[model samples]
Target: MTEKVLIIDDDTNLLSGIQRQFRNKFDISVAEGGEKALDMVRSEGPFAVVICDMRMPGMHGVEVLGSLKEHAPDTVRMMLTGNADQLTAIEAINEGNIFRFFTKPCPSDVLAKGIEAGLEQYRLVTAEKELLRKTLAGSVMVLTDVLSMIDTDIFGKSTRLRDWARLLAGHLKLPQPWILDLSVMLSRIGWVAIPAEVREKFKSGESLSKKENEMIQRIPETGKKWISHIPRLEPVAEIVFYQNKGFDGSGFPDDEIAGKDIPLESRVLKVLNDLAGISQDTAPTKLDFRQLDLQAQLYDPEIVQIVRQSLPKADAENRDLYFETAEVPLNLLIAGYELLSDIETKDGKLILAKHQQLTKTLLTKLRNIGEIQGIKEPIRVRKHIVRKV
Candidate 1:
């Protein structure tokens, strides 16, 4: 495949000459000035290399290439200028992260060689990024899948927490929401360390002894330990470490960090985790918002307000529909549906509670429960109707 090259020069004649020289060797694009170059970079970019003339009207080549570093870092950058002073070269390299620096009267062969090098750099950078992305994705999938197999209950909780976190993050227009989503999914990973009996007892809402409570408090730390070893998961580990932190610095792993000192992602997770707990009681009510507010410093006030304002609209968007257990397709049991009543085993042990969102994991667990312990027929669920805008 041919690599694309962009050449930006204020001198129209020079631009035309460069394009004509390289057009046959590569897919060449020409831009008359820095502004036009930037526009092309943004709109028709992912170019293998960009060659810019240093002196231009309105944004200089240094500034243009710097913007490209932010907008398209994988695109290799080169600067051409008649002024080849040491300071100019240093500034170009430092600010624009230029891969190559050439004088205005550079020979065609030298420029071509530079473009070849730049293309190679672009390929290497993009390939590394793609590899990192796939590795991270696969690692997360394996961990979450294992968590799901080990304990569906915890997996179900993570799914709900992720849903709430995603919704709240989207509301706030938080950047890189996938990080928050992944953090929430693995937030309960520490539970794997707890003994099965203790885990079950905790899930059942039974009173825990002092030792048991202490063990529970250490869960986040355990999660941090588990995740810290994974490459590129440093931020995720920190968020998991502080997931139980309070707005007032009152929660576990008691530290001086409080208020905005806590990572924004951690604070968001804390709010969503608490909200998920509240929501499990049934769909949250106005009173529930009041209760959350009354908790005093447990959550960020701004986030709490956002949640309060969002709930009514969320509720309005969802209308209730019912379906029998056998008739309900697995795909239909989507996120945000509430259970009208307890889904219980034949022995009357509650499997899933009323008003809990019917996540895919939960639905699979429900089906497994039906196959294993057996459930009563005509299982009823309150499906949330998403109204068309």
Candidate 2:
């Protein structure tokens, strides 16, 4: 756990000076130009602080800092330049998100303190992010494991779907944790509502009758019922309900949600589910599920392309963790909500519905901030069908 400091400057004298100044206090790596510096930062990091020169031949310090921010954002950036021009400093601060600006005549003590503080901040921020990632990963494992018992087939599908969902999320450049892990895990809960015969038929490429299609439509409702009761899953439940939705407003149950109005998670999941269908089915390779999904009105064209590009990469990392750990729990249906206590045991119906709505809102806000991927539409829960009393 040694703290690493990266010094990038065209001036070998200044680079050596800084390296020697901090030699006793920190571990240092030096580079003469921006390109070489960038390569170092990208490959051998977790760098604690990056000290860069503003004036250089190949790439200026500000430009180098910008690239560093993109490649290793958590690394603290400092600009060291001879020029004290206020406008240049302001621009660097705004564009490159520079942490500290040091002039050429900076005192050794002051520069040392700046580097130390920057490294401290980097350590804190990276530690927080690593903790968050671990937390999210742990929660995902628990939830996916539980889901495996809920439905073995769905567990396998969910694991595969999550692998693909992660790829789609990255392809779309989404940052939401729950959307990537939870949405894909819960996407197949709707299948729990479909009869084994219908699911087998759907998987086997058998076309269903109109009545069968309508029955299949109720799967979302079934998903909602189960999802609403799980407090931890409330946020991504809409994806479970609407992964089959159309981007052009042609998906099942509620069709009014279209384009950006649809949750991003839903849009991402739509592509994931469609691709999973293509992979699991006997469709010929290069059948272009994205084209078929968009043309058939199951997914948006934009979303389809995003999925298409990421599919190759996702396939490379598809571990099928969810599917392998998932199992058909004994008395799965009868043991609903045993793991969750925040949900109502007294007012089961009303509270569950309310919980469903709250989770949808939370997820919607998270998506708007560009934190998650999937649907671009908000899925409205359909009212229960009323038969003649």
Candidate 3:
């Protein structure tokens, strides 16, 4: 596919000459005036470059250049003028974002070089933007994975945190570099600093000692330390640090900053965090004393009331299953697929396929060869067959 080049000019001879010069190098498109040029830009751009001639009838080159900038800002703008006067150059720079300014009869080599440079610039800018987007996405994914390892208990609990954060950001009309609900996500990264024994203790319904409790309280500081190296993640770190603080200036690190002073994202995070905590341990069951204890202690009273009022009755609908059981060992099968798939018996040693699925199944078979094992109920496995992509 050839790159389409649009040349806008009223002078027919000049247009023909320029078109001929680069006809072999480009797939060319042309328009005679500003309105037509704008139409071409709207309909056919993402052109690599747009070259316009100054001193045309009706709308001047600068005006056309400005319109091009507005319509297709990424399309590099080059001005061709008979005069290289100070005012015209300044106006082209300020108003047109001119990529390269050329006096009339621009040398072919110079114009070619400028065109090449402009295209390269466009590619670099585009690549840089794409890389940044991927980087941000990768960072979020890394954060999610880290959180998963930190506390598998709450790993998938905050599924809707990002959606709620985006919604709250829109409602609060957050500015660019939006700062909102990262507090909830990064909040649990502090759990990494906590000993596994502490987590196990919680699972076993044991309370932490006073010193252990104090150490747990400082977990957010650990999170801040870890994320401080990432400049873009720093704002999220700040929000994570203050997640325990309340909306009414009643909670930790006493600054008495209430209401809006509490970043909207942090406030949203606090609500979502409570919602997730309740969802994980209490789903499929009605709210009980434990849920109430968390609500009263961990959440803003107004926010809690809002959640209760807004709680959808449809949510009471039961899901298929909550926990993995032998009857639903399909998830484990998916994880251990490679291990179960291949196995070889050697002298007192077994070599399984790099695939685990076959190995897992064989192990299960040998372990329960005569006695009933994993026989309570059979699990359903869904398999799809498709041609190779």
Candidate 4:
């Protein structure tokens, strides 16, 4: 909600005068030159609007704003110059994505109006992206929730993979972490095509017949195809497709893609998925660590260590900072709350397990199940509210 604006000009007098004139109306900060403006962007940024003088020493307005386009993409950029040349204006618009161009000695009121318009445009565009993400996320969750109902084990593991991926992601720099999130959320969706009995046997560590094995082998490809059709999800599909591929280049959908060639998110997911599956009942500690060590060559060693670090911290964080248990009715359940106890039928048959986060998709599944099978009332859950620093 910050309406912060930054004005950059080599002329200190002009910069100070502009600040004084509009300081009461806007949250304005003045930078003496391009370098100072960029520094402020890195240190104190996400400004809603930035205005730069076109003729600054060493760096021109186009260069400054072009760099800003990459560094703070959502910030609206404007250009001001005494020249008012057509070439400068064209280059500014094409290179810097400039929102407004002003010649020197522009009326203060006109400049203020332009600044206001730029701020509103920034707000509108960012809001639309946010809305699209949430709406898309909700729609995707519907698919995951359906998978959960059909195969609880796979869906639960996918959720665990998502949490573990998040922890590992903190140690790495990913341009699009949400791609990993979407990748993990729908990681096991490919398994939905396999027969329930086959999936159950796999979970029980039983060997599958040749035909059964073939179906299981094709899961990653099946998942990739289904996801790729969605717009803006191509990267997500790639992550999912490679989720089972070994970091050492040794797993299914066999190809030459190996060692760092595989998507990093997939490698992290691969480790976490196997780590969780090795012995689900045991504490996520040394027990899982020793098991992963046995299959060490199958994963990225650095990512393996990241998972190792995540174990104790995640357990402690959940118990101390996140979990607050409450027994609430099904209708009161909210997305993001983790179940602390098993959701089961009135006859005590297990439905959803403890520690599974309630998502909107799962909420719908819970409602449908409540109506159809009649679940136990006052469900036990841990409302996951992170304690702020």
Candidate 5:
């Protein structure tokens, strides 16, 4: 694919000259001012490099490039200006994070070389991001799959928590919502450390001894330890670490951090976890809103309000949404379908729970397990239903 470059300048003549200079070599886009440049960056971006004139009509090049750094950090940035004062250069380098600084009288050859270097930098940055994303994603999948194999109840809880987390994150308009989603999915991973008999007993709502209760209480800490070793999962680890913390400085691991001091993601997770637990016991009704309201000290009050407002909408959406149920052979089962009923092992142990959304990795593992241990046929799934407008 041809690499894209964007040039922004107040001078239309200069813009035209630069476009003509590099149009043949690179796919070039031009913006007259900083505002338009930012608009283009948002809409038609992922440009390999962006060249901005330091002095512009509305927004300074430094401001524009600084904003770009926040919006698209991987896009290489450069600043060009006639005024090459020391302060201008300093601000451009410090604030804008410009990859290259050039004067207006800069030779075409020099500018061309800078563009080439900037594109190279962009390539390196994006390549590293892609690698990290894939590696972290794969590791998470492996961990969750292990959880599914060891204890499907925990896996099912994670899946449900993931769905609720996504909805909450979306409602709040949080950036990169996937981080919250991933945090929720892996939040229960520490349960693996508990003995299988203990886990089963806990699942059955059996009263636990003091030692067993302590072991259960330590699951979040154990999960944090597991997540901390993985590269690029520090945020996830932090979220998981504080999942049990309360808004009023109450709850396990006994950290004094409370209220806004807790990460927003953690606060959101705590409320959702409580709500999910409540729903599992009994279907939440409007009357239950009072119970949640009474528990305000336990959650971020603002987030609690958002959840209250969101629940009715969620209910309406769920009611309107319809899924076509179908029974498919184990080998033919595809990912992204919701399980309508529990999938159990030949010995009647639950392998996957109802309402869990299947994933590619989960499906592949299930297939492998089936081939080894003979799974029953006609696995029930809720087929993806596309609503008519």
Candidate 6:
């Protein structure tokens, strides 16, 4: 990727001279004043670095750079000024988060070094964000994949929720959709502590003992505890912690954080979690939001409206995949095919839940379980080659 640079100044001569002098050394774009520069940043940006003259006709450097801080926050901002007073430096640093301040007669070589430094800073900022976005999220995903081996149903539901979360978020044009996606995927991480029988009873809609109910109620906080320990996942942890919070402020943690004061992603998850519950009781293709509509006080109306429109479409998309399924025996089982029904023993004990994708770990578990308990032959599955879920 090119490390594109933008230089903003009112002097056409200076702009042209700078462009010419460093055109070979850097990728350069120039704007005569702040307004035009902002327009460029909005329309053609992801600029690696921006250097601006301190004083101009309108939208002085501090103001322009402050705006840039909002628009292209990752871009390294630097200033060149004839008035290099302490007050100017303080204001620039406070407002613009300037990377470097240069005096008016900055040598070409010195300016070159500063710009290079700014570019390096930009690279570090972006690279760290990418690591957090990809690598950190990846590590979290591996943990969830382990969850799949433990409880296929929870993992399967989370996977399904991710489909809806991404779809609804896209239709609504929400920023940072990945945050919502991660929240949905990790929504059930709290269930890791619950004994298999307790989780099963809860899933089967069996009434739980008071102690069991308390354990179940703590799932979100448990999720928050495990996830919050990771660096920079605190927002995701907050969303996980608040997934069960009611839009009308009637749910747990016993706080007054009602309505939109609840995190928006949590609101999105609240609606989606209820929808996943409803889907559990019905056909995936007929997944309904009307039940959620009746409980409007518990959800964000906007998110419910979008889910009502988008979820059936997401379900319909996978209907064809189910239509082309196959039933394979234990010896023939392979990774990447999705289970369409629960895998059980010859004696009729449930071994793995339905809607789970076969993984090497799962396949090994099935085979070992087969050797010991004898798996039922011809397990029903769909060939899952599309690389989703």
Winner by lDDT: 6
Off by over 4 Å in 4: 165-175, 259-261, 279-283, 293-337, 340-349, 359-389
Q: Which stretches of candidate 3 lie over 4 Å from their true place?
A: 1-130, 163-184, 202-205, 280-328, 331-389
Model 6 Cα RMSD, 1 decimal: 4.0
TM-scores for every candidate against the unseen true structure: 0.70, 0.52, 0.48, 0.82, 0.78, 0.82
User: Where is model 1 poorest over a 10-residue stretch in terms of lDDT?
Assistant: 316-325
Ranking by TM-score: 4, 6, 5, 1, 2, 3
In model 5, how many backbone clashes occur?
A: 0
Clashes of 1: 0
User: How close to the true structure is residue 15 of candidate 2, measured as C-alpha lDDT?
Assistant: 80
Reference-based lDDT, each prediction? 0.78, 0.65, 0.61, 0.83, 0.82, 0.84
Clashing pairs in 5: none
Worst 10 residues of 2 by lDDT: 349-358
lDDT of 5 by residue, 1-389 (tens): 36799999999999899889887877889999999999998778778899999888889899999999999888899999999999999999999999999998889999999999998888898788778777766777777866776676667667767666666776887756768877988888888889988998897999999999999999999999988987778999999999989899999769789889998989988887777666632124565556677778989999888887765432434644765678988888888777767777676756787767788877876887787776766788867678889
lDDT of 3 at 165: 52
The TM-score between candidate 4 and the true structure equals 0.82
User: For residues 243-304, could you state the per-residue lDDT of candidate 1 as single tens digits?
Assistant: 99999999887889999999888888887777767664433567667677778588998987
Error of 4 at 218 (Å): 2.8
Those runs of model 1 whose alpha carbons end farther than 4 Å from true positions after fitting are: 1-80, 102-131, 149-151, 170-175, 281-285, 309-343, 349-372, 381-389
By descending lDDT, how would the candidates be arranged?
6, 4, 5, 1, 2, 3
Question: What's the true lDDT of residue 381 in model 3?
Answer: 28
Higher-TM-score candidate among 2 and 4? 4
Model 1 quality (TM-score): 0.70
